[model samples]
Target: MSGPITLRTQKALVTRYKNSLATAIVQGASVLANEESPKMLAIEATALRETAALVEKALENFTKTADGMEEITEEQDKQIQAYVEEVQAVVANAETLLIRIGAKRTGLQEATPMDEGRRPTVTKKTIVELPEIPIPTFDGKITDSENFWALFDASVHSQDLTGLQKFNYLLKALKGSAREAIKRYPITEANYAAAVELLHSKFGDKDKLIRSLQTRKETASARNSQLTEQRRLLDYLFALVTQLEQNGIVLNGSFVAQKILAKFQPDLQRRLLKQRVVQGNSEELWAVKQLLTDLDTLIKTEEQVSEMLPENEAFRGGTKGRPPPRRYETTSGQRSQMRQNLCIYCSDTEHNSLRCPKVDSARNRREFLKEHKLCINCGKPNHISRECLRSGCTLCDGDKHHFSLCPKRLPTALSSAGPTKSAYTKSSRTTQQPKRADAKQPTSSAKTGAHCINSENK
Candidate 1:
């Protein structure tokens, strides 16, 4: 009784409170109403007072029971909080009705004399006004049904309100398809229950909820390779598994562990394996729970490595002055086209054949482009070099060729194409004609000394 309560026990307590309140409301409906005769109203007043006292006692006991339980798992804590909020709403609504009934009974007693009694005396009781509880709305999402219905039931459905009143509240609280579904049922007192049943049948199906959770589980394991993604994936899986288990769907630990590992990148999968989550050489069983710890450690280590890289030059050994290359950009339409065509050289989807790293060297790339009958200027098919409209050879400002395969940037460029020009070209657009060689040639002594200095420096 002092320790943490089991889920079964908590559910039973909520069920008991709901059943009791429902029975009380149903049995005392006539007496709880405002249109009773003075004598009958006196009898009804006694019943209403007894019912109110019982409700107040029940609420106090419910609160004490919750407070007595020790703190446990996060899921348990959430359930407890939901239970408290739900029950509090129900009790507050019930108390509001009870106070109204009491006021009506008091007015009846003062207005109408009781049989063989002097003019009835009214005993005033202090009433504490309750703050309005905001009701949650539903937008036809299956995932939202659980939360939406819990608050809906506590504040509206199970309250002392009439069916027509509840129906109005229901209509106000729904939107999208949820409202449309209930709109078919006219807002009559009789149709309220039917509308509630219809919504519960459609969106509140237990099987649908379980399937949705399963779909999310599968998605969590699909290509979530980055540290941030993996961390979020693990946390999501933990909550997902907890929810599935709560619904009596137990997953196979080994199967789930293997499935998740198989979906990771090969290097990441190997690192996880090295953590000894999977034991035995041939018939290994995966410890699914241990995966969370290993994955967390891997994420932390990766973040640490990334943080240290900028500060430690030895760890980031690459070009010193040049910045890293910018990632290739493509519009959505271009990406769609690329997906259809792929890289003509290596069949890669991310880039065109001209940008393929596999077709190394300017000579090979140009050969591939020519052999495929693609435009040498832009590397796209269907047009000749001159006919192609794209500007050409950004590397050397040469005409009729792409910068990607420009011979100027290639060290092994063919000698027939002449010595590779300086990668640094003049920014000026004006063409300067070659100067006539009117000056005398340099002295043989000066040329020899310059050549000697260059050779010695090398």
Candidate 2:
């Protein structure tokens, strides 16, 4: 009709029985050896017999109940087995003590019943001391409250403390509003549970706690402050995630990764997204670590570049909201200098090489040739000047006189315009004069012609 005994209850009962039996046996042995009176020895032996009977009855009940129980878990089975072994060992010791004290065995079997010379020696057990639990303290601050409650709750549940003891420890950890809230309650074991319930009712608002973890946004100004906003955002997110987890809101790695990425600016988000794509199936923790590392490296590189540049040139290109001033003074000075050194052919300083004039002339000449189709030598398009094979005076294209002796070769505008007309007149005049006079006149004309030709060449 009765339910199965819990491991805790069974262990407690077994421990108590062992302690009582050991105490009674030690007392009986001490009285029998030290006391000269048979009356005292008999009285101690009687007490020992009663204690042994109690232990034996309890062991019998435990064994019957443990054996009858079905559907026992491994942990329960181990507990029951350990309890039985301990009880049996205690009973054996009690029997040996009874035999030594010259008392009758209380319905318990002994291994060496006939050997009365074999005496049992009690060995002192080595007690292992456990380390003390550290108590957490909490102020009214939300951050402190969260950390303290987690540790405090774990410690209270794990330790074998009474209700009053738990309440006292809780009070010792509280401060400010939390401590004040429960101060009016009487400090009694009966009121401990009520006090805890009242404290929770007063302060525990899940919605408010959840709302406190609102997403924080970084400002544009904060960007110039060397990642101050980013650091703040990261800390807030980590705390928010931890708080959410504590509240039993389980989030997956991808979901957390998305949440973290969402908090970043558009540029940073895009960069991190690209990185994630490259990495392929990275977890939230790894993504965050890699993101932070990249940001740090980028910041360091920028700082190094900025350091390398001259202070005046470092911020020369103004940022988004502002435009750099136009440097008119330096620009105007450079323009004036360029104008002074401008090319004679093109009237531009951009062209300073010998090829520039040649290129300009060739382009113009080609255009002219294409339009008029004229040759430089005979005013005909049959061939170019270089391929002209007509046999005549080299200077004027005349057969009457050699090119050097041509009288029309003068440094005059008319000569430059049309030398053929002047050549005809000079040739006719040379023919009309006498041969003797003509020879003398031709010498002066020849010298004059040579001088004019040299001047034209220059």
Candidate 3:
């Protein structure tokens, strides 16, 4: 007597009931947009999907039911069909409509298309932006490292500089030169006093050190000084790190420097607090220095054993530009090739004599002469003498013997007939001077003329 009772039928019936309930809930919740926690805004989505599936199932069942229920109540069947249609329409329309309303109501901004087709909407969805804290960056390192020591390797590699101080001055220049580039003004090896005048001009009279203190008091009273000083402190930290990094102390110096700064700041603040009560120079460099120790002490490491010397660190690349380790053992052939590649003995493009496996070992064979103590010019080994081919004579251990017995040093009759030293000097001095001078003048004049033309063009 229970109509079509089965688990399948019960499940369908439950699904139908759920679909109806979901639709009711969505319609009811739609009015609660004003209520916070905004639950209704999301429910509409679930109702729409459920309602679509329910309508499809309801239609299919209605088709099957009609075949069996022609004998049942016609009015009831029509009512069920109308209800399903209405629910379907409601779900379909409400889904699109509510979503559009929610998008507009929640302050979702619409974007204008820059060109052509349908534009994507751009809305400032409320995002949590964390408070910004400045950080030291690697780029600042490159700009601050202009000192001669920093630039020394580059200069030597390029053959640019001639002196060491010039190299140092160049590095010192990095602080001032990279002022705007660094977050904090560089604490240069720069004469701090001289920079004050410059900073005064650059930062304005308000930017001057002494003037800034008085203003800082006023700003602090007004609550702006708190912000400004914090900014200044941050800037100081950034600049300090930047300078250290340029000097090749990126990892080590920045950490230790920060530690010392942490130690120094509270003391500095107290000193400034005292200065606030007293009247003094608008700019305070001495008090700053007194509160802050010379960076020289900072140069010594934590152990105080040895300091970080710039030269100790590899200038161009890591520790040494030692290429990556070789995978295979070098063969004898490779060693020979390396020797050939690095030949430095002579201008001979043919072969390297220094490490050549084969060399001219005839008479003055270099290795034989060097080992056996023979003269290099004539080259007979073991006797230590130079032998000349022309005279066919061999002397032991020296070159003067060759000069003494030479077949090539005979005098000619014309050579003998030539003028004596005194007569020759008298004639040569009088005649050669004017002619040589005359010969030199035209060529020198031509060179001067060419120089003038080039200079004029420039």
Candidate 4:
């Protein structure tokens, strides 16, 4: 940082490095401070401390990436987003739910007493019992999910449990709120495991549950383990989105955006989607659509999550390309003072690069001879200049009318084929907006179906 005014003179730089005078001054100060070298004249000292400002600027190029989230609204879409948020909230214990006791949840909070009010009428088919099968059967087994017959027959609706109680308890035992904390960023497996231990507080000692689950049924335990892993993946997605909000200018943020492969869209939870359908027959379906519109609006303050590892499965061996060149205009005086003999790429004052005709034509015949390349028209490699191809080559045989060995910039054949279903994927998968069409006459949209998990069946 230290330098004298005299060292920055323009004359000292023009003959040598064509560097910044400020740099020369700083180097002069450094040499005098060290005192290891002998004394020198002002001109001699200035010549030694030369460097390019252009090179310094070129070395500092940092690029930014954009977040690429899709937006959609369908009956099933709202359900999935809400379900994801609910899962996060539940796991974070940001909100609490009255839940039922299961294997590890031996300690239970008694169900809050209820005052009878308007309630659904109990019927025979509504109740069913979950048999204590030594092995929990997903299909034919009498399980909690299938216990409608026994539950209603006994006039027993599990008062303490939320709709998510069945699968969440398993997750709660394995995951806890730690998974939700990562909704804003990615978490390592070690962190996820620790979060699981933190979440199993009231449920009981988690180590014991893990031991029990392992000791009791070794085979089914693997399937059960897979479920927790899936939930962790969901958390990782949230983390990815959160990081984007802190960085890139992503297009949009919604549950539909994360689950690009419709496989993860949570279609089974579309209770609201069905409700929207029935209510489309009535008025106010429009209001229902608004709910989803707002839910997708949880976009963070920042955008662009490009720094995060790309989630695209198509990414091949990881090698990002170098950034483009950097150019800044110099003032008229500086431009005038610029070297007339310098090359365009390297501004050294030997020979101007732009006027270096040797790089282009027959003027550099010796270069072509040395490389052993001849013109493509005349059967050659090194001498076939790019300019020759632009003029159109005679090597027109197959589809490659030009360079036979040249590859395409695009990857897939379909990329250039105009439109496809992918363009509408985001819109088709989000909240199923309530019938926004005037109640006076139902529109084609209402008739098709809404994605609301609240009402409409579609």
Worst 10 residues of 3 by lDDT: 311-320
Model 3: residues with Cα > 4 Å off, grouped in runs: 1-32, 35-44, 67-73, 89-458
Name the candidate that leads on lDDT: 1
Better of 3 and 4 by TM-score: 3
Q: For candidate 4, what is the lDDT?
A: 0.30
Better of 2 and 3 by TM-score: 2
Query: Candidates ranked by TM-score, best first?
Result: 1, 2, 3, 4
TM-score of candidate 4 versus the correct structure, residues matched by position: 0.13
Q: What is the C-alpha lDDT of each candidate?
A: 0.61, 0.53, 0.38, 0.30
As for lDDT, the candidate ahead, 1 or 2, is 1
lDDT score of residue 92 within candidate 2:
58
Error of 4 at 309 (Å): 39
Candidate 2 or 1, higher TM-score = 1
- Candidate 2 lands at a TM-score of 0.32
Distance from true position, residue 31, model 4, in Å? 44
Candidate 2's C-alpha runs over 4 A off are 1-132, 140-146, 215-224, 227-229, 245-267, 276-458
- The list of candidate 1 runs beyond 4 A from truth reads 1-134, 221-225, 264-268, 277-458
RMSD of candidate 2 to the truth, in angstroms, is 38.1
